[model samples]
Target: MPDKDRSQRVSDAVHHRRWLILTILLFSLFVVVLDNSILNVALKTIAAPPPTGIGASQSELEWAINSYTLVFAGLLFTAGLVGDRVGRKGTLLCGMVVFGLGSLLSAFSGSPGQLIGFRTVMGLGGAFVMPATLAIIMNVFERAEQPKALGIWSGAVGLAIAVGPITGGLLLEHFWWGSVFLVNVPIVITAVIAMVLVVPDSRDPHPGRLDPLGVLLSMGGLVLLVYGIIKGGQLASFGSPLVWATMLGGLLVLGLFVRHELRVENPALDMRYFLDPRFSAAICAVGLAFFALMGVTFFMVFYLQSVLGHSPLQAGLLLLPLAAAQMFFSPRARLVVDRLGTRVVCGGGLFLVGLTFLGFLSLDTASDPWLLCLLFFCQGVAMAHVMPPATVCIMSNLPRSKAGSGAAVNNIFRQVGGAMGVAILGSLLSTSYRHGIEGHLRVVPRSQRDTAGESVTATLAVAQRLGPAGRALVQPAKDAFVHAMHVTAVGAGLAAFLGAAVVLAFLPGRGRGPCADDDRATPGSPPATGRDEPDL
Candidate 1:
């Protein structure tokens, strides 16, 4: 009776502090995810000359962005495994320190290469921090409260993504371009201190020996795949031998990695988890949702700035509706899932996202800003609905022991999807833009025509150089860009719709319990943990 009372008191203490712990975790998560998009608004400043900018070349600027993403995505799986083997709280703390130091170094970087190197360090830190947040949440929250905790966590991430540009724009307005990276330092420091006080150490109880071969295969495959994707986007063609070779090689290596893991005594990732329908369907849903969102946002920044004549600050403010809707609806999404189940909520959310993408097709230079804001709000609503439910589904399906690994794989899908979407959509945009304007530029000199056909920014620059004679090129260039935006929007919409279809077909219906369909197990399936059916 005395021991029972002691246990009850301990439980009460933990439960009392849960929300505080969650706040710290969410803040940590915010910084890591913010890094992914914060640099978007700063890239131009970083490439400009003067005390305010670093004068990086265009290619260097691209590398500055891609380097962080490539390293972050490639190292995520390994980070997750490491966190699971080590303690998640310790990993989170170390990650925060590294990330803060990296940001400080980035602010002091003399050249673009130095800044890029610092960003890579930041990415390495983020890989550790991201998975640890999810894993900690999975460990701390009770099953009944998991959805609510996850909802808040997901909302925080969505909010960070939405607000990242605004934060960058505001910083750049008053400070040097390096301030964007520097802003992370104070926030990370605060979170690191809070985490140490409130968060508990958690790790896999029976983490087996590391799989070096699996590690090599997975890391190499991801790095090569991302490199191929980025290279393909830059060249605007998958026809390049280097692109195909790298992508194919990455795929082959990943296949071998999976095979080796299945045969090994202690695999890095348990392949059996993929056999579960809920896990598989949820992964697909999250991947497609991010792919569309990332692709749209990538081009939308350019469109608002280059075509609509909005300042970076104005563009950032314009995106507020999207962010607002995401934050407002995400915490409520789990409720919708409770009533409708993952199948309906996830499928319907993606369907709505697709519709919103299609709505962009109707936009023109003269279109109302309010109208665009409404569309963005709708897109955000769809995203809010999709992500929380998908996240809950994925996390709930995995046993507590492998939550870190599961979270890593879930994020891997998102990162890969974002990378692919950006590459493919950017290629489509370039192709359509070039085809539209190349014919119109034939009357100009070959060099000037080639310059004008390169990009809308180039066309505008070339037009300025031509003075009044370039007036003929201005409207045509904008028109070509609008045309490309339409084509890309349609393609993005199609991908989302197809993903929704896959979710509907593969995901079990509403009446099925969480583990009800586990009877059709693989040869080496582990016993079910009897997780609740998400209050549906």
Candidate 2:
């Protein structure tokens, strides 16, 4: 067979088997999304008896979550490019194996530090998994087929986020908290087996040579940037030199990394994609969407656990309303995006999420838990409308050749937003908590008041020492924390509204039609033009 003839045959094969390709792609995506949220519900379970030699406040509690996202966000672009250069199948298999190994390690961790180390390994695997899946979907499907496939992809993602917390909660109840990590082991092993059987090997036909320096610069820049977000609140003062250096240095490095890519013959990251407005807009929307999500997750969980004093299981159950809303409305979301346009659906969704947060201000720490579910349910409805459509628009608009990189870019911003959302929200919650605690403590006797003013970690310890009085003080401190969380909720909702403003202004309407570069996903086609980055 001649080379040209064989290429044509392969193209035909890809189009014919696109659905199978999409299934494989979404399953891998399921794993990546699942682990991100699964552990949040476990925060309390792990903190309860507290792992051997682990203290909730002193331990690397946040690090366990932050590390995975940090690594995932930082290395994602390089991984995408690597997949395009190497075989996507090989890249994916490598990622799965590492992910499985990390899950196994997390299950057996004897200390908080150790668990975090392994989670970082999982994040490394995530960097590979996320882009490869999206790239393959692009590689296999035609442009017209992308929205339907992406809708399905988004649905799987919705299911993952919805199921993760519930699954984690079940794991904690049936076994130890470690079981939460153990749950990934079987899922990963199964995915690996399926990959060997189902996934096709694909790569960039005219792949450029790898740029080692560009890779390092981009990855290092992301690492530093995320590191700053994770540690910013812990800094002695908001304007500390160390925090400034890391954050500033990270941005500088990323800027240099972009410049390096433009200069290099075969850049690991192709900066030219940014030149395309459609692609840029898509990436921007994804970032903002996740930013809203991360903020909600960060504050809502504490609102349930710290404010309302719900058990981990109880809190997990409350989220079911949000999950249910997504499940019920997902199909509708797809239809709306296809008919009304991506911007209208996404912008409207953000408005709802903002309203949910705004409405939460009506409650105090003593507010009814059932009413809180109404807010959670609104969030669910909001997410169901936005997520799938936004993903479809972004993935569809990007060129097929750069699909992996495009998805990776989107995922990276989402992770960064997730990290920052948590950091910023956490800081706000903590600051407000201190203020609320101080005001409440003033009404109590000196001996009783000091415990309320103590650090959250210290109060937990003093409760053990104080006997009945300590338990009495617990309610007061918790009340303070709850009031603080209420304030945080109002602020987070408003921030989401701000993110929506960006979408309303720049995002294109659906029925208006895709731009010229829209057909850019055509296989064996040249580069695309005129797409915006959907952003954070």
Candidate 3:
């Protein structure tokens, strides 16, 4: 056969397999997102008192959420590099196995500490799986199909978020809290089998050497940075020597890591990606969007369960509109971006997010639940617009050779943003709640006052245990929680609006300059070049 005919045959084979591979990848991605959002509903069951609950504290509840994202974010850069060096498909399979094992162990964890530890293990697996999916998508699809492909991929995320809570709610209604973790096992097994059989193996031809020092610095820096931020918020004092020292040391180390990466031959992440205006803007939009989304979610689930006194299933049902709106809008985001340009679409999305958050400020204990649902629906639509376009913008800016790194970069910001959002906004709520209840708390017995002031969950428990004596504590605590949520919503709205302003100022408009096309893999491909940004 002629060389041309053979090449055509290989191309045809790859094209035939692409959509099948995408199906497997989407399923894998859905499971990861499912596990993430499902935890929100389960946290209440895990922490509440009784045979059904473990009686964990507020801090423990926060850790149960944050630990996974923290470790996942820290390890992502290293995982992406490994995937590029090895095969992406093999890396994904390894990740799925580990994730399944972690989930199995998590199902049996006897204490909060054990659960958190196993969650970190799942995060390690997630680091491998997350980057490989997007990297594979970039490799398999042509540029013309990328925006549509990404929309579908983003839609899977919306679907997972929609499905996770309902699934968790149903399990908690019928089974134990451990059932949530156990559910991932079968799904992961199916994903692994399908992926191995259908997905094509791809890796960088010149992956170069691993950057051990860069990896160490980045991981350590992110962990310390997030740790310090969480502590600063919880401890309620930036003046604390430990807080300042940890935060400053983390910042200094991150600075050094950037300097080192610039000097090294094989940087884990190419720093040059930031020089693209679209790349930087896309990353920031994703980060800011998640920052607001996670902060609100961290609080909303608790509000529904603890404040509104709804059952787990009811709360999950209430959140359904969010998923519905996201699924409804995300697939159509590409059309909006094409018509209005990324700047208008993304900026408009953030503005909508801000508007809905502002709307949340009006929510009181007496406000209708459907009003909250309406706000959630709007926010979901806003997120759909922001995420897909931002994803496209970031992937479009990168060379295909750097797809693994690019995907890692994109996810890292979103994860870090989520972790930070929880830490910061949660702290604000805690602070305000304490302050609001302080005068009222003084009327209670000193012993009961401290316990009641700890959290809404604790206050409710104390109220139940003490009967009428603790009854007075309930109204005050509920009032404080509502007030705190209002303040936090206002702050979140401001942040979303700020993100929109930044994107409008910096992100390039459509057809304004030279854009780099996605790099198609060919043997001995040359390094890609683009118009560099002006120096800082």
TM-score per candidate, in order?
0.93, 0.88, 0.93
State in Å the error of residue 521, model 1: 11
Ranking by TM-score: 1, 3, 2
- Reference-based lDDT, each prediction: 0.82, 0.72, 0.80
Better of 1 and 2 by TM-score: 1
* Top lDDT prediction, candidate number: 1
lDDT of 1 by residue, 300-329 (tens): 887887789887788888888888998899
Instruction: Give a tens-digit lDDT track for model 2, residues 181-266.
Output: 78887888878887787667776666666678887898899999988887875442346677778999999999999888778877
Task: Give the runs in model 2 whose Cα sits over 4 Å from its true position.
Answer: 1-17, 48-59, 235-237, 439-461, 521-536
TM-score between candidate 1 and the true structure: 0.93
lDDT of 1: 0.82
Better of 2 and 3 by lDDT: 3
Cα lDDT over the full model 3? 0.80
